[model samples]
Target: MQVLLDTLAPADAPRVADPRALTDEDLLALYAPPQQTWLRVNMVSTVDGSATGDSGLSGSINNPADGRVFATLRRLADVVVVGAGTAKAEGYSPTDTPIVLVSRKAQVPESLRGAPAGSVLMATCSLSDGIGEARELLGEEHVLTYGSHRVDLPALKAGLAERGWGHILCEGGPHLLRDLVFQGAADELTATTVPRLVAGSYPRITVGAPLDAHLTLRLLLEDEGTLLGRWFV
Candidate 1:
């Protein structure tokens, strides 16, 4: 991918990238969190703004370039926070990086459960009777509760940060992203616009309430008609 725009670069030196040589390490330099406790979201959408396809998974809209950035960001993140719905829809599971599954129902899919205690965490509330069962099925450290009525995103994030997981990478399923916005937890967003268009009932990349957020386009790159962009939110 080549750089099309880079507002994050110094004013004196305009940004430029050589598609022939650009690497994931280079992308990491441009996207690494600048602060200790930070949140960055990564997502891909179609030209028609559909965040997913009939299968309710964004993997169908992804490409090689997007895959590289996805892997790189996870490598740099202290923890990966994902909506439980997306985790189930996308067949998410534990990997080398730690993951915090956010859910109110305590309905963590079977796939994400039974992972190493050091690798997975489930954030839910007291109302969900499945919490104890999930903890037993997974592990004790695998569950955490925030609010009785709802998941307190700020407190959830703080608890993670206190555990030395400061740089947060949120892989949204829309509602979780919306919650992050409502709680003012997101700091950056990296989105990839796929070349294809799908005119379907699927919602746009963001389905949250209209709340004005001040953001600047920090970087933009493209390859094979796929637009990769980042913003400071």
Candidate 2:
């Protein structure tokens, strides 16, 4: 890891001489948000602005540096929020961390099935189908229903905050990221730009209606040809 630019660094020096020598704790500190209650998004993209590669998946476009940052962000977060589509596409499974699967539909992904009790949650709307099945699988307390038409992101955040999950990390599949930003719930974005070009019809990090959200870069790091940036929304 090469420290290109960091707003948190001293004015005399804008970059670290040997960021690669930093330990995991150092990395975690570098990416920590200023606020205790924060919504931080992590995403990977290509140089050509495509979010996916030939396989139409983010993993195909990610590198080891991005993976390190991803893991560190997860470690720093109190809860991990992800769209249902991305969870299935990325083959998400249970870990020590709790995961909240957000979906407009009530169907739970196959990979999340049989997960340990209280390890995973389903977040959907009251209008979704299969609500009974979702409640039965994840337990009634684990199934969070907010809006009648869609899962209200703001309400969901409040609910999670009420549960003491102040540090929120969203690993998106695009649509979810867009909604978070559009809803003004995103506090920061940590994006990694892989030094590769994959021109296709793939989506960007955020998809959906056009947004004019502004982001200010707070930290920038590079490893090999990859660029990892942290921006406040």
Candidate 3:
């Protein structure tokens, strides 16, 4: 990818190599988390601020450039965190890395029902009716309950850290991203803006009560009109 700006690199240095010429290793080096225990969110949106295309899924909005970065982030993370809604909507399956599904409901999504043992986990609430089902599907040890009514994001992060899964990546579906930011549980955001205009009723990258958080842009890259930005929250 072409480096539009990199705060860590000297301005006098040469610009980035060609985007088309970059390999998977090059992308990994570019997106590697600077800290060991970091929480970063990866999201894609249209120029018109729609998080999804007509299909109403994030996959519909992403391009090949975003796909490279997406895979790189997943490969770099110790655990992949995603909301149950996104997991279901995107037809998520077990990845090489562990996946933690955050849900208000206690039942596991069908897409992840056959996931390998210990490869997937459910972060739900004790109040949810299907806690037993969740526990039965993913062993009791894998089902983490934090809050009474909802999955407490901070506590979930702490719990993951305790398990030595510190390099965290959250693949969001808006509401989960909003909760992470609102609860001060997110460390950074890596957003890819696709060069399209899908002006419909789709939500923004984050959806919830109005938030007023300032983020510092640490890196910016562009490839084929798609802009990838890394912002520290």
TM-score of model 1 vs. true structure: 0.91
Q: Which sections of candidate 2 miss by over 4 Å?
A: 9-17
lDDT of 3: 0.89
Worst 10 residues of 3 by lDDT: 13-22
Candidate 3, position 45, lDDT: 97
List, residue by residue over 142-214, the lDDT tens digit for candidate 3: 9999899978999999899889999999999799999999999999999999999988799899998899989
Greater lDDT among 1 and 3 belongs to 3
- TM-scores of all predicted structures: 0.91, 0.94, 0.93
Estimate every model's Cα lDDT from 0 to 1. Answer: 0.83, 0.89, 0.89
| Position 57, candidate 3: lDDT | 92
- Alpha-carbon deviation at 123 in model 2, angstroms: 1.2
Ten residues in a row with the worst lDDT in model 2? 13-22
Question: Candidate 3, which segments miss by more than 4 Å at Cα?
Answer: 10-21
Off by over 4 Å in 1: 12-20, 208-210
Best by TM-score: 2
